[model samples]
Target: MNKPPQNSAEMPDYLKARRLHLNGIITLMGDMKKLNARANKNAKVERLTIDAIAAELDLIDLQLKRKCG
Candidate 1:
């Protein structure tokens, strides 16, 4: 039988996952800012897109808090 891999004390699995999640959120926020900059062209559509992204970020925040805390 093969032994399962182990996580080191320096960096646990959850922490690693949290880091990835934070990075993704950072990217999403950056994209949202970019969209906001050009939002004047299509205010209605871009507003919806920004709202969706904000909702997603909120969900991710809740998940990270539950999982990481």
Candidate 2:
């Protein structure tokens, strides 16, 4: 990753950024999932990008869930 992930919530802010990140990731994953479901499942480039995003999202979700971090 070119940029380090930013965390804005500290003390008074408290998990605000993490929660928002989690939510946004979830929304994106859901949209990707819908696309995956509707997709032809045969295109190489399309499948590759979708798979990559899904894999990355899974990692982020696991980290947020305290299963990987």
Identify the leading candidate in terms of lDDT. Answer: 1
Q: Residue 21: error of model 2 in Å?
A: 9.1
lDDT of each: 0.59, 0.55
For 1-69, candidate 1 gives per-residue lDDT tens digits of 333235444334544555466567668766776777855667676557657756765665675566557
**lDDT (10s digit) by residue, model 2, range 13-58:** 3333444665676677667767877674556665576577667656
Worst 10 residues of 1 by lDDT: 1-10
**Pairs clashing in candidate 1?**
none
Give, for candidate 2, the lowest lDDT window spanning 10 residues.
8-17
TM-scores of the models, in the given order? Answer: 0.45, 0.41
